[model samples]
Target: MGSRQLESFVTERCRSGTLTVTEACHLFDRLLTTRDPAPTIYPFNHLFTTLVRMNNLTNHYPTIFSLFNQLTQTNQISPNVYTYNILINCCMRVDRIGLAFVLLGRALKEGPGSNPGVFNPLLKGLCKDSRIHEAAAIVLDKMPKLGCTPDLFSYNTLMNGICKMGQIGKAEELVDYMVSKGLQPDVVTYTTLIDGLCKKGLLDKATQILQCMISKDLEPNVVTYNALMNVLCKKGEIEKAEELLDFMVSKRVQPDIVTYSILIDGLCKKGLLDKATQILQCMISKDLEPNVVTYNALMNVLCKKGEIEKAEELLDFMVSKGVQPDIVTYSILIDGLCKKGLLDNANQMVQCMISEGLEPDVVTYNALMDVLCKKGEIENAEKLLSFMVSKAVQPDIVSYTILIDGLCKKGLLDKANQMVQYMISKGLEPNVVTFNVLMDMLSKKGEIEKAEELLDFMVSKGVQPDLVTYNILIDGLCKKGLLDTAYQMVQCMISKGLEPDVVTFNALMDMLCKKGEIEKAEELLDFMVSKAVQPDIVSYTILIDGLCKKGLLHKAEQILQCMISKGLEPDVVTFNALMDMLCKKGEIEKAEELLDFMVSKGVQPDIVTYNVLIDGLRKKGLLHKAEQILQCMISKGLEPNVVTYNALGCTAQTKRN
Candidate 1:
């Protein structure tokens, strides 16, 4: 074919998606052999652009790069600025940003010095990889050297990236820098800052930025409003979110489907499904069709409330409305079904997802695996994991973690360890939560030293020990009677800026109580209160039981009264402790009065209650009263256990004696 004919053929083939990469190379060689090469850059640019449009850059880059190399050998065609731009974007898409800069040098040496479009892709890639500091350096340092003057879009990209990295402070500085450079921040810039601030829980600062945007006549769009509303919703400030929604409407910035979806999601998260439903209806009334996200939000709430039938009905309603369910939709339903112990329905949902051509992603498989693991079907979970690999849907960290957790629960530590190794081989670094799960299992199994070693290993691997990690370690050490080590660990937690929470305090107090260090436990309780760690019911119950066991009934009663004074109503267990102490002291009248008090407080006595009261009355030779108590226990629908029968038999034997 002539050069012109070849170029036309390639363009048409590329447009029609009929040209393979190899065929394009053959056609390019034919064009180069022609006396006149009919602008090979155009055909090459078209092909590269087509590859980008396919959104499969990582898969296609090798094939396209091979063709580029062949054309370079011939030296019959040179890539223009457009060609470089396409190539730079392709590199960014695959996170091969370093290659993008090398190409930028080639473009600079060739012709048409690099521009923002070339560098923007690099910034995007860096931001996506959370390399925001490097991205900023490129914007502020490298771009100027390349004669690429960073524009508004460039600054906004950097700002958005910084915000996503959770460095809202740095983002604000970037905004200031943009202002100093005379590059005006637009709605996108302000909205990005607002989102970053809100996510950081600096909602007041976010509101100030929103107000600043309004003052600049930027007139916050639906995106800006949605960002603010999303933050408010997540903070459980539903009233504020509702007010913001009303303000957005009052401002006449016509709420889009995304705006309504954000509001619905916020309400659903706050467990206000009825309000979320109202928003859905309002959106429908306004002729704004609810998308899959909107339906998924409602369905998630229904599933969590264990209203699986209602969730399914919402799914049907969505399908009827021609809103197709994505992987998230199916995953939500599957998770809900699994939580409700309807494993069969969950599996059927997976099948339905497959039948509808919606391939179950890792999340879908994780849901199934999690259910199987919880049900003790560990072998079945492993089979499903193998199936996931066979289907080419690579198991993620969550998938391996689920199986590891299941195996650990089933006491298959060796197999769980193998799965961890397998995950590492697959290049998946176990996250802190995954490490925590394994560590928890080890600790519970009395492998304190192994658990400690694992903790150290996770730290070396760059997984920062969170509160849960320290809690697990401390709990394990306490259980092993390594109380001094556990106490030192608490000091380490404080040094690490992790304030001891109620769980941490409870663990310590329980150990002290067990060791009969009542005075020390009391001192620790005081210290915990001083540290602003309010003692939970578990903490009080532990102390009360400890005092009662030591025959310090008055002290235990004092603690009980203290709990009540703090507005903490004693549960049946708490009352039972005090009653057991009184019964042992032969304070039969006091014990009876306490029982009446518990019943008046609506704390229904259990089998333990009847057992203690009957034993005390029988010891005092009140066998008739004890029998009457047994009749009352039966009438109260509390089943007496062997302890109750044994105590009554002792009373009869004593009466005969």
Candidate 2:
């Protein structure tokens, strides 16, 4: 075949993703010895460049470079800057920066004869490799010397590199230089600086630069506004960001995909998911397509807010729109499903990703394992762990923590400990959540000292104790009757700037009540209400039960009424305690009244409620009322147990006397 025919064949094969680099080179070699020698060098250079672009030169760099050198030696064609730049880019892509620089030195030494096109690719390679300083030096030294004036693109690339390096001062200096050279900073230029400042968390500085850009009569483009909005939203200045967005719309700077993404992410972070959905709808109305980042941000927020159904809907919408779901999208849905205890759905999503030819990432495995663990499907979680390892997907701390927590919650403390040991053996450090789970499990088993010891160990390991850590330890100590110790822990949590949540307050109150310190429990309850921490059902129940046990029926009744006034309904246990207290106090009428009130309020009385009333009536020598209640209980499909029989027999004996 002619040399052109060979080149066409190689190009076709490379584009097909089926040709090996070696085979392409071999075909090139055969074509070079053909009768047609004129087109040989260009075809070979084209093949080598194609290989570099295709990212198929991993183990064949030396071969490609040697072929280029051979083309130069035979003088079939001279090697230009494009060929060398392509090789440099290949080196950078493979993280071989040193080799890239060697190519750079070769290009620079090639002097005025070399094509200045080399500088563009070189700068791109250096910037991508985070060698921004080197790239900046090249831009300063090479472009002018080659008589190649730096374009707007070159300046933007340099500025972007400097900004990403967190050298905003240097980036500004370059921007000023670009303007002084009569090259005005365009939207790309300002956007880069704004993005850099935002990334470094200098929102005010970013805003100032944006204002400066606007003052320069250079309108803030979509990118400029999007960057500022993203930073502001991230910094929790969503309102101000929205205001700027309003300005953007008024100025006719149409919001792009990124603009919508920034606002969506911001709203989601602020728990304004409904607003986020609105922005997403607006984006679609504007004909802007929601990208993967946009969908992932929306999915993440929805999942976190326990809006799993909406999140799933979004996932389907994204798929129907032909926006491929990345690992992040899958992971978000998996975590949301797991959190909602939908393990089957979560697993199906994972399998779906795999079936779509996307390998499950570590995050996918971790999320699935977490759901399985929470569902008490420990065996399935373990199976997933093994599958993760088998598939070479390394398990992270989240994976192990999920398993440990599941085992601990299932009362498999020994297995949990073994897992902890396994994590340590594998050189993976346990995070705060891991230790919290273990300590909570130990505390529930009444191993208060062990829980405390683990707490100390966690702190010693430099894992800062968060609110959860404190709450678990305090709850454990309180449950073990170590009220003083638990209270001390509460103080420590406050000292650390962590406020006690309602759970902490309730635990403390319950501890005090169990110790017969009803007055202190009441004080705690009052303090909790004062703190604006609305007492949950457990809080009211504990205090009410404590007062009732102390024969303080009036106080118990007052608390019950207070709970109702506060929009908290009493549970079955609460009603039973109240009835028992009233009956024991010889107020059978009041006890029956409370039962009627409970039923009237649509609170179904459990068997315990009826038994308490029946026993109380019989004890008060109301034999007819007691017998009527027994028959009423049987009619209600509540079988009379031994307590019921005993109470009835006692009433019958008293009646016979």
Estimate, for each residue in 1-657, the C-alpha lDDT of model 2 and write its tens digit. 766777677667666766667787787677566665555445565677667766545777777777766665664555566677677767766777777667767766755224546666667777877888777876787677766677787788888888878999999899889888888888789989999998888888988888888888888788788877877888899999999999999999988888889889999889988898899989899898899999999899889989899888988999899999998898898888888888888889888888888888888888888778777899989998999999998888988998999999999999999999999899999999999999889988989889888888988999998988899888888887888888899999999999898999989998898888999998898898898888899999999989998998888889988998989999888988888888888899998888898889888888888889988888777889988998888888889998888888898788789
Question: Local distance difference test, per candidate?
Answer: 0.87, 0.84
Best by TM-score: 2
List model 1 lDDT by residue over 1-657, tens digit each: 677787788789888976665676676666656666345578878877776776555777877667667766777688776777787788887777778888877777866456677667777778888888898898999888877789887898888888888988788888898889888999999999998898898889999998899899998888888888888888888899889889988989888999889889989998999999999999999999999999999999999999999999999989999999999999999999999889999989989999999998888889989989999999999899999999899999999999999999999999989999999999999999889989999999999999999989998999999999999999989888899999999999889999999899888988888899999999999999998989878889989998998999889989988998998999988988889889999999999999999999999999999899999998888999999999999999988899999998897798789
Off by over 4 Å in 2: 1-87, 94-99, 112-120, 130-190, 212-218, 235-237, 268-273, 297-314, 515-657
* CA lDDT, candidate 1, residue 641: 93
lDDT of 2 at 117: 62
